[model samples]
Target: MNQDTTMHPRDLLRQMFLAAVEAAQPARGVPPYLPPAPKGRLVVVGAGKASAAMAQAVEKNWPGPLEGLVVTRYGYAVPCAHVEIVEAAHPLPDAAGLAAAERILERVSGLTADDTVLCLISGGGSALLPLPLPGVTLGDKQAVNRALLKSGATISEINCVRRHLSAIKGGRLAAACYPAKVLTLLISDVPGDNPCDIASGPTVADPTTCADALAIVRRYEIELPQSLREILESGRGESIKPEDPRLAACTTRIIATPRMALEAAAEVAAKAGVTPYILGDAIEGEARDVGKVMAGIALHVVQHGQPFATPCVLLSGGETSVTVRGNGRGGRNVEFLLSLGVVLDGAPRIHAMAGDTDGVDGLEEVAGALLAPDTLARAWAKGIKPMDALQNNDGHGFFGALNDAVITGPTLTNVNDFRAIVILDPARD
Candidate 1:
């Protein structure tokens, strides 16, 4: 659907936000897609910020006995009576994550062809399930994770490196349940929601080569453990490929994705009486650079009304990166907003907002931030420099100072980034 030809700009913006959030709800897609109970045993396993809720959704609706384990980001866990839900660190591996990974691997053992394994995959599962390869400790994986998170590497690039170093990721988990029928239901947080990229594609076949993983590491300059370096160099731990016969019985389903959520937002925009232009759902690059480009487009709409007329809204979804330099918080959405604020310089009639659909930008509690016509002018009046904030990677503080931070704590599901640029007509004197 296209933008709304009939609603207010603010109303359109709000509706867009609501649509993105609605598309990610666990209850919306996770329940009805479940496979029939296994004749032998139905074992559930998953990892992500939404795993806990996904687990609960399974427990509430399943007609047969359900037993298993799943891990989620700390503070994101929801209660479930049957399955054990473990909380662990995210974006970085920790000891708790290691423990959970070990337990998960153990759960998949001894599965027969009659058994069914339901795997719930979502964003943040990469770090939530960390079981390092031989001779590499959890600390080694943590260091690499910290480096990658700060390196501005894309999600696909980061996961390539991660797949090589873990025992559970990169199709190993699926291999463990060899004879069983594995059904994977995923909530995509990556740009394209490629099954192999989500949670490192534990239950799906991997077509990525070990050399591919090595190239990504070198591209990102991510420091790796001596053993990890050898593991990739030797190319001994290659994951199951697309043609691997062992995975013939496996099935993967993407319940939600960035594109779907973007479409939902577009529908909301149409309902709100505003014209919406969807640039693309797979955008990538440094957050600040993208913001500047978006600012250029927004300015065009206001000045020439060429690509889109005034009273139009620009919308997009996808994950953006941030190369962390400063010690301050670095949510990609906030970084984008701060950069846009500088480029826009509080231009008359142009306002924008960039936010993570998961409701947490980077590691900050705030979902993202917003900007209005006077954002930059107001910051300059208070002696706050937008460029300085960008340099310090303190987008949160920069937006917080202007009281423009969008704070929505723990919205649960993650589809990726939701960005909107609202353009309106100039006021009459």
Candidate 2:
């Protein structure tokens, strides 16, 4: 569905987010990338928030029989008759994930050249398929993951560490399917849509090494378990290199990405008669900093119209990081909106929305939050200081107080964050 000009600006913003999400749905993105059925048995195995949905899509479209297992974050699973959907913890590994990883490895092992292994990957797979190397336990991996998340390391850095520590990631999963042709269908959730960064490149070859992972851990000052540190220093948990012959037959395809989602949202805005200008789809860095920069861009667009004229919508996608320094609920999207509001200070004739396509921002069930020109004025009316809220990293509380937080439960798919700022012509308003 397209945006409706008659709809409220907030409603239009939400419709744009939903349209972006719909474009990344597994059913919509998977079919065109599906390959010809293999002559031998088809074994499907995957791990991520979207893997279960992707598997279901595969089953619905496949002409032949398929058997497999996929693990997804809790509450993100969809029913699939042939493929078993195992729900597990996300952003962190659990016992279930470890067991599923073992089973998945076993499922693809000993495959013949005639057999085909289909690996459906997406965001969160790194945590959903954590199999630690020998001498390391799941708790150790969990500790590292927790530290990395809180350390404000980019997803690439975080996944680099994960790839080294994981037994299934970093092309090891593809190596296990050694003589078999492994086809990996990915829903890209990382900036630049790098195949190796998505789910830590379980099925694709990894060019990083143990030393690189160690450098990232050191750079972030992430305290790793002594044994884990030893493993890294000793080069024991090194990932499969790009020259590995076992990965020669493996093919990776990105079927969905943040750019695709942003483009879809742009189409909705265009349909509603709003010119959509995509800033960039690979934006990164601190959430608050990005918000401030976006505010400047919006102001420039509204005043000078050099970048674009008013009555236009600015669109961007990509994951932003939040370095939490307070004891408040932290969500990158909400934090971004809050910081943007602080800069706007009730600017005239502008509205914006920021949300994660996965439907959850940070640890909260809220997707993100909305921003109106008078956002700060309304917050002041409620005795809520936007600057203080931003400092506390309490975007959830700030937006919740105004009843402006966007909540969408679990979207069952992830393509990173979506942001849109609509600038209305003051004269028209």
CA displacement after TM-score superposition, residue 147 of candidate 2 (Å)? 1.0
Worst window of 10 by summed lDDT in candidate 2: 1-10
Per-residue CA lDDT of model 1 for 272-302, tens digit only, reads 5556788988899999999999989888877
Judged by whole-model lDDT over C-alpha atoms, candidate 2 comes out at: 0.91
Error of 2 at 385 (Å): 1.6
Once model 2 is optimally superposed onto the true structure by TM-score, how far is the C-alpha of residue 314 displaced, in angstroms? 0.6
The deviation in Å at residue 194 for candidate 2 is: 0.5
Off-target runs (Cα >4 Å) in candidate 1 are: 1-14, 427-429
lDDT of every model, 2 decimals: 0.85, 0.91
TM-score of structure candidate 2: 0.97
The model with the greatest TM-score is 2
- In order of appearance, the predictions have TM-scores of 0.95, 0.97
